[model samples]
Target: MLKNAALQYYHTVCSPNISSLLELRQSRKSNFEGREHQKYMLVKWNEISPNTILKKIESNDVELALSTLVINLRNIRMNLSPEFHAEKILYAKLLQACRTHPAWTIACSTINEEDTAALINSLRSNVATWKAQNKPTIEQFPRRDLDDSEILFIDPRYFNSNSN
Candidate 1:
């Protein structure tokens, strides 16, 4: 059978080298000369990698940095409309992103609620812990009255003249 041959070829020749599926499609609108009016979308084809945000948090050690990510995810979810599959996929992506944060290890380990709020809360709590531990305390120093009499006094020797 033709199907049998195709399966055999796919398994033997194509399975080993390729790690992922490469989808190629030609745009019907390619005939248009200029594409300036077309809005370029990022997530349409490119996947947002967790490593991109992980590096920033690792470098700065700030939990607030994660807020932007949370907001972006929320926006994406809202914009995705009625696509349940896309929303679930986005949630999974966010959960994966949350794993990269050191303080979020516990939260990321358990899959209680697959939502952005839960993840954001966990990040916020961890940030609070970091803030508490690293709280900026003003160090007090003993104040001493500056003695200015010596500096104000002029040397008497300067007034004395040995000779004209």
Candidate 2:
């Protein structure tokens, strides 16, 4: 059952269409090119609270959330709104948490079996690097759980035109 789930996630992330950004553009249509998907992302990002995002990650929808995030990041251009910036920052934190998650690590390894050992090693190295960068914040990731205590919510106010 676990293997099956991991394989499904792998296919979802690494499938031909998903693996290619061009395919993402062609199929999603609204990704990076159209405002439709961007609008959808904006609505969903706002509708879903931080706690809900954590719940989604805990429920193993990390890939979906991460994919939507990548799409949103690519979609917005020129001006970055506070909502958009908040969405990006929040999703990025969720993604980092998911990547370092124990179960997620195993699933990722299964997906990249062609380079399983290397990938796992790389993940560990990356975790160490994130730890060095984040200090105390990094300690919460290894426990393999997402909850209110562990979430890092970013303030939308932090977004500034000058920063971009």
Clashes of each: 0, 0
List the candidates' TM-scores in order. Answer: 0.43, 0.22
User: Which tens-of-lDDT digit does each residue in 1-164 have in candidate 2?
Assistant: 22574456446754644766676547444333356645655665444432355465675343454444444444442223445455445434344444555434543444443443444355446545544654555555476667888898778897566765
Global CA lDDT computed for model 2: 0.48
Off by over 4 Å in 2: 1-32, 59-164
- Candidates' RMSD to native: 15.0, 25.4
Question: What's the lDDT for candidate 1?
Answer: 0.55
Q: What overall lDDT goes with each candidate model?
A: 0.55, 0.48
List where candidate 1 sits over 4 angstroms from the true fold: 1-61, 76-87, 133-164
Worst 10 residues of 2 by lDDT: 72-81
Pairs of residues at least 3 apart in sequence or in different chains that clash in candidate 2? none
List clashing residue pairs in candidate 1.
none
